[model samples]
Target chain A: MIRLHRCCIALLMASAPVAASAASPIELTARVLVEQRQAAADGTTRIVLVPPARVTPGDAIVYTLIYRNTGSQPVPDLVVASPVPGNLLYAGPAEKAAVPEVSVDGKAFAPLAQLRVDGRPAIAADVRALRWRIAAPLTGGAAGQVAFRAIVK
Target chain B: MMNRILSPVALLAGTGAGLLIAPQALAQQVRSGTAAGVSISNQATVSYSVGGSSLTTSSNTATFVVDKKINLAVAELGGTPTIVARGATDQVTTFTVTNLTNATQDFRLEADQQDVSIPLLGTDDFNVTSVRVFVDSNGNGTYEAGVDRATFIDELAPDATVTVFIVANIPDVAGITQANVSLNAIAANSGQAGTLGGDVVATPLTTPDSPTTVDIVFADDTGLLDQPRNGQQRAFDAYRLGSAVVTLRKSARVLSDPVNGLASPHAIPGAVVEYCITVNNAGPNVANGITVTDALPANTDYISNSLTVGGIGTGDTCVLNGSIEDDDAVGADESDPYGGSFDGATVRATLPSVTPLVPLNVGFRVTIR
Candidate 1:
């Protein structure tokens, strides 16, 4: 990363006068930082617990999830999911994106909730998020956020 | 004392009178009644005062009126007389325009508009907002080629191309493999807006709306429907300006009072209605024995707006020196916004003071009637 930074600085110094068509503005040292400005419901119902903003090589980063329903309505069955980051275990309590029936890779998902609908526990497959699913399908006017982290295997 | 000699009836009558007099005395307690009077004669003199409140008091007269009672006086809008388009269509087929407002709209329509409104959807879905054609008094829809209508712009000069229209994503427009389209171009009219205020937005609005939708102007974007006129007879027949030439396009602003809701029958006190009027060039051409004239509509009373015409011939300015006259319509109705009260109307003329030769800029009315 240090060498990459030095290389970027050398490249910037080589090209002068052409200000606009320069390096990517979102790059931090090397990799581009993806700014996902996802809103739960307009500005009213939102839950932005990075749940796991950072993760160590082998240690799981814990998140204290806190969410509120700022609007006048309630939220329903919402699912939170994320691709299990490399070299980490989802530590029993998790919902992964991959599965034996659905997983392309060995990565699999397990729901963190046991919600019963119509007097029957909902199948765990129903709660798993897809490749690009949000933290949850927030209810009307209701805000709910959760916490999860990948532990180093 | 002479007061003690009063009868019982007189004492009772005096007691009741004293109670009523107490209010006037209490009102006068504010000091400074130096002999003024609010005339009980029922005659009201309205004046539009901008700076201070419309209130004055004297010993005998009190003229205290709220600001709401005063009419808003706006400057006469539109400086130079502009040619407003009535109903115009440029079609390869036959075209027709009848008076929609049922009044003599001072506008001209040139056929061969190169564009006309045809229902892109079902024929039932397409609507013609207006079709006011400048027809001959004889009532024949076809142009006599060289008579009544004037050709201001022809083949090349009538080339001010404008294309704007409402295109919807309805099913009927998509069904045709190939079809001819139509759209209507209307000359701007001076009256209430065609579309009511509510129809503008499908949803409820936080504010009320204007009366006329035609005034809701749209910029000309030739990109919408600019297909060349598919070979059509698009020419205007000319009108020879005669004694009934009726065209004196005079417009200039003079210092005048203000009036708002200009069409309203009753005016605000202290309102200086800056009246603006145009005696148009109902052209054919200015004839030798011509008497260019104009009549004011009766719906509104002429308050105080003077009329003047400048730059008549070369550098000559002329004034119509006389009291204006008002003509009354026999059985006119006032259900609509304009055309004044169902009474007599005032008329003014815009003729060059000394008519020797050349076109004249006859103007009138800088005073409230």
Candidate 2:
């Protein structure tokens, strides 16, 4: 027996489809803690990503860095150099609490001519986003977050 | 192709296709099954004894007397009706009302069941996302008549009410009909004339009705255009005594066909972006051939192949690229003491398209006379 249900209506005009935010465990694997440790320069208050992780194809990882200036004298040309991971997609703009600078490879550098944090966004870059430079000098015992995105490959 | 694709005018100008929609009961009717042996049976009759009224052997009246007898009618037949939820749009919620029992037992979900049927109708039909119902005494799901008599607000008795509030797209839908409307809201037993509660039944004393007026809203961005200047200065900055600009827009209006195909005219509706650049003129002694350049956004395919400046050796300049309909002149009014004065003496070029990360170079060059 077929019951004609007029309940269903409008394709484009039907009730909003509930946004299913339900998450299922598609795949899960835990990594050992020893495999994910980064070493920073001595006396310098910044840590560098020796081997960056690719969270996704086009995702830039924002690492929460904790740095303490061990030295007494205030570091003037205080530059924090974190290279953009070569494997991931390009990073857009970055946010810097202290100062900002940008580099492609490890060597050549460009003074991030324009450093700004929006009343809203942190920075704007050509690439989707990843790394950014804080162009300000670090005084001592100062920490902040730098955000950037990676262009999807 | 107009309707085949979306109607552009309606998309940009007016909201076409009001939130009103027909019941999308479309089906491809795909089915798969093996033949379970088909069985056929004739309709059987149930004969229940009436106990309320006894028929006189020689009754003067021809009317059959009604009885308070249990009508145990167990007429068994085969198949069950399948009601598949038909529409697939993300606009409004819909529900089905099925009279499955032989005597049309008005059934509602536990939530949509009502206490009374006099005022408003019970939510037998699903129209919105969730379902609601009424049961006064035993809210714990005893639906048999007289067992746990459901007390609901009755609209007919002027105490109960039933209303189905279509909570979506209220602004878009205009016409609502009350043909077979079941009430979800009612003010009943105003002065203590009625009991506290009752189970609301979803049955139509009259015709069925649906709500009109649906709401439709769109998402949007909030902020305005803002930029943090990079070292790269525009050419007009060099040409500024007080203020000046490069007339590169002429290149957009009058450039030759490039080796590539001609680009579309730069006159799209929502494709203009405002930009500012600063340039400096380095001098040995009054470098006369100074020129500035500006590049079109990469998204726009160049109509003419390339852009070239006739003479650029006097001063720095700033260039602005935008839609053709815009009448904003680059160097409208200004003076210059740093170098020779030229009103619209900047260069212009159109890039193939915008390449993120990869810099699509768009700058002026000096002849260095």
Candidate 3:
């Protein structure tokens, strides 16, 4: 009788798919990185990215955003939005694959030329958030990454 | 294709969310930059549509801790060197030590005498004795003799400045005018509120980064005779000699004679002759405790109650605008203030302190036999 009850519970758990299907089909990940200069064997210098062990003022930092489609269907209208931390100053976009739209007040978004801060033209340091939209649809099991550089204030 | 780098002004202008700071506090933060142990976290979100449905997913937060930047500044307080009199003790040259680190720090002070030339002053040619260092214990800018006696700085906060003094004794050396000294301050760990901590050295680059521990970095700029990234700074000052250059001039003038009356005075018998001794100090320092001695001329009688001191001197004669003194030197009239007295054959006069702008005069009258 105990085995029959355990089997009945397993059958009930195995039939529950409606609640799990409501989850999002895209996976997002973020990372912070720093660049280091190394003397190569060819008597040349090479720049490489690594995880920062310590961060101080005036140090340049990179924030990378990666997205992967995990569902069986393709995901369309994929938009990635990231807010610049208060203690970090936005330097510029690290990747040139897609130009990101920035917002100073987190309400209105536009190109770098159309934004203003305190009634003056906004520089890259005044950016509060950045958004990048993929021009093509992301297929199932496909991944893409976007990155930007910021300085520790 | 457009790239913009962050400027230093924008980095130090303002920070934090909804945090209001005063102008002075903002300036202090600019020196130390971001505080240590501050956590900076960032997260990204992605939103997409699938079959007429919208879904959103957020990334894991990526965070890093700000490390401690050990830095400090030492500066001489005054532009000109300290003026010290010869044989002066406990003369102080002031300096200010400012903590530019991101956290509270203790500073170890060292006062050293160098033979290098000080700016605007000549080369150091003498050595000072009993050199010592002191910190301002009461947060006051002035250096008190016995009150502010703390040697090393205790628990100095970021962007906060404290007064330091290098006190020494000036020797009475001839032909020696300037002595140069330097004050060096090294960053240290802050142990307690009123206690000094151990010295802090630069963290080696070979040490691996531990996410939980706050690493140390030397960010101090180069100072006088000090290297960069050493968590220390040094500044130089000098002590200039202040001495008196006194000049004495003596003159004699005939007052009156019994034969010629007051019309034509001559050095004849029964004539009163007055001798004037004028002392002038022309150096940058004042002279004190000056005494003038003059012997009566041969075959001359000393006039009683006619000796006076501290009078004004003109071109060649002494103006008798001084107090009268008796013939004896053991009475109250001799030193009531400024006076002179005659003792049988010689005259002695004592005057007050002589300054650079004023001349002290001593005058006495003698009768020719």
Candidate 2 per-residue C-alpha lDDT over B115-177 given as tens digits, one digit per residue, 9 for 90 to 100: 222122211222323332333333332233343343332222211112211111111111211
Q: Over the stretch B216-267, how does candidate 1's per-residue lDDT look in tens digits? A: 1111223234312211112211111122234344333333335543444244
Q: DockQ of candidates 1 onward, in order?
A: 0.00, 0.00, 0.32
Candidate that would win on DockQ: 3
Question: 2 or 3: which has the higher DockQ?
Answer: 3
Clash pairs (backbone) in predicted model 3? none
lDDT of each: 0.26, 0.23, 0.79
Candidate 3 local lDDT, B90-177, one digit each (tens): 9999999999888889999999999776555567888899999999888777788889999999988888899999999988654467
Task: Locate the minimum summed-lDDT window of 10 residues in model 2 chain B.
Answer: B231-240
For model 3, the docking class works out as acceptable
Q: What is the TM-score of each candidate against the true structure?
A: 0.16, 0.16, 0.69
**Comparing only chain A of model 3 with the true chain A, what is the TM-score?**
0.80
**How far off is residue B319 in model 2, in Å?**
87
